[model samples]
Target: MSPRKSVADTRRTRERIIDRSVAIASVDGLEGLTIGRLATDLGMSKAGVLGHFGTKEALQLAALDGASAIFMRLVWEPAADAAPGLTRLTAVLEAWNRYLETERGAFPGGCLFTTAAVEFDARTGAVRDAVARLYRFWRRRLVAELRIAVARGELPATADPEQLAYELIGAYLALNQAIQLERDSAAPDRTRRAVARLLAAG
Candidate 1:
């Protein structure tokens, strides 16, 4: 192949590796991602996989980025066009619930962040930092919406955006636990109700 075609194919292969790594890291933890395992799964040589990422850290980082992109597409993009207040916030939350319930292919073990949080909560390194950053980004997004809602008078002026964001995050964590641990079929419905009540009380 020409050099340009070869470069294009290499880029595509790198993306494929990242995609598979994210899927595996979701089911297993990021620590579970090894060059050997990925190569076996993808029918590539260990050297070939390592050549793409150079290090396990690089592969893990790439997986995290890939998962973040998929998450934004699945949960945030659908609600992007909604009016920027409670309506948009509600759309985003509902979109998240749908993604959790329906997008099993991308997150076979449940929320990747949730899994990573438990795995790396006590550890310190680039991986932990990346996970924390993602969490902060997600929380900030919710806080922004809550602030908009408060400013628009959809929520009480006394409402605390940070507190509201905390409750919303807890609801999602609970939903994940319910579905993954208790094998609960009603968790999503319960979460939706809880979110509705939280908004109503605002």
Candidate 2:
């Protein structure tokens, strides 16, 4: 094969590895991601899997990156073009409300960031830092939108954007847990109510 063909093949193989890794890590927790398991799942040799990423940690990080892309595609990007402030924020939360339930093909185990947050929360090092960074970036996005809504009088002038962002994230996390654990059919409706109440709060 030409060098160009070889490069294309290499990229395809790496993507396959990351894709399978994200699926496995989403369900089993990042700690449960093993080279042997990936090899078996992908019909790859353990060496082949390890060759793409020098270490298991590297593979984990790659999976995290892959999952993040999926999330932006499914959740954030759809609402991205909505008018800024309350309109955009409302659009995002609505997309989020559906994402966990609807995007089973991309994420069979619910939100990868939610799983990663729990898996790495009490730990230190790169994985933990990566999880925290994603959460921080998302929180910042929510807070910025909330601030705009407040300034526009869409929300009360006394509204606290930082606190509203915190509550919004908390409610969504609870929504994920409810659907995963209880298979609660009303969880989405409950989340919507919570969002409305939180937004109307002074």
Candidate 3:
């Protein structure tokens, strides 16, 4: 009943809502998120859910943030300790593949960003902006390592960091489609081959 305990409880409850919202949005897309559904799923009232987020847009944005945090923890943090350049880049890419292949429990329908990018690719507003920002953040992370590889002579002097980043992105896009859309058992192997070629060329 203390003021501090009440505030802490409120924060915890808000995080709980965001956590569930992220999981739902990963499968259904952010626009499909509804306070009513979330409330029912969480056993809270619609008013309570809406009160925490204030608006549907606000809730969607919060869910995007939650998904982003989950992604960073799962994908990037695992490779964080590797040495910079090819070693770290390989670790990061391998971590990413493993995250996509094994982290289906958190994202049952594949990558959250992949789904959101398709859904919001044609839309405009804060939600779309957030999605774009996350994409840029991820690509920049990859490109930074690519640049380090170049500096270390792991890659050719003429290698294009941005182009390499694009190729790696395409590999994952194909992996997502192959696994989720085609249900291809060989998709992971295909992706690893593509990644090997992409890096092997540089």
Candidate 4:
């Protein structure tokens, strides 16, 4: 009889599965994720993969959670020390730009959340709802920062934090597309210039 796996061993296996799922979902949309392909890629039986998640849809949701965890670690955690307000917001944006440029190992195609948005925008399902939740969480975070910036006079009193948050998030999305779609060599520079112009506006 085969030896039973330890709890730690099982947890490690789950993390490995989630890591692969996030990477694949980044390149191919969540719809592209399948148990057969994952088994083939990971050299595990389809049964072994299914043992962890119990179903394909569950695996996809796990991948979304994994991607969100990675995104926060790379983009937001690095700016934890910055003073809240414009300084923290600027640091977060810089970290975000670096995430798009340098997180190739974690996300080969681009941001998985952004990719999921395009894939599931027109669809109605648990997956679409999960994607929308991640986006809303990010927008709220930016709006909070913008509110602080306005209060600190880093931005004018007349500034609308909600609108500014919308534009800031839009800027990051454009940065992702410029890098992933256009293959623009100067994508970072252009994004920085655009962000500066946005901040300078009354």
**TM-score to true structure, per model:** 0.98, 0.97, 0.97, 0.96
Model 1 lDDT on a 0 to 1 scale: 0.93
lDDT of 4 at 7: 74
Best by TM-score: 1
Which tens-of-lDDT digit does each residue in 1-202 have in candidate 4? 2345677788888898999999999999898889999999888999999999998889999999999999999999999889999999999999999999889998998999899999999999899999999999999998998899999999999999899889878988999999999999799888888888888893
Pairs with backbone N, CA or C atoms under 3 Å apart (clashes), candidate 1: none
Residues 10-111, candidate 2: write the lDDT tens digits.
999999999988888888988889999999999999999999999989988999999989888878899999989999999999999999767777678888
Off by over 4 Å in 2: none
Q: Which residue pairs collide, candidate 2? A: none
Residue lDDT tens for model 1, 1-202: 8999999999999998998998899888999999999999999999999999899999999999999999999999999999998999999999989877777898888889899999999999999999999999999999999999999999999999999999999999999888888979899999999999998887
Write the candidate numbers in order of decreasing lDDT.
1, 4, 3, 2
Lowest summed-lDDT stretch of 10 residues in model 4? 1-10
Rank order (by TM-score, best first): 1, 3, 2, 4
Cα lDDT over the full model 4: 0.91
Instruction: Please tell me which predicted candidate would have the highest lDDT against the true structure.
Output: 1
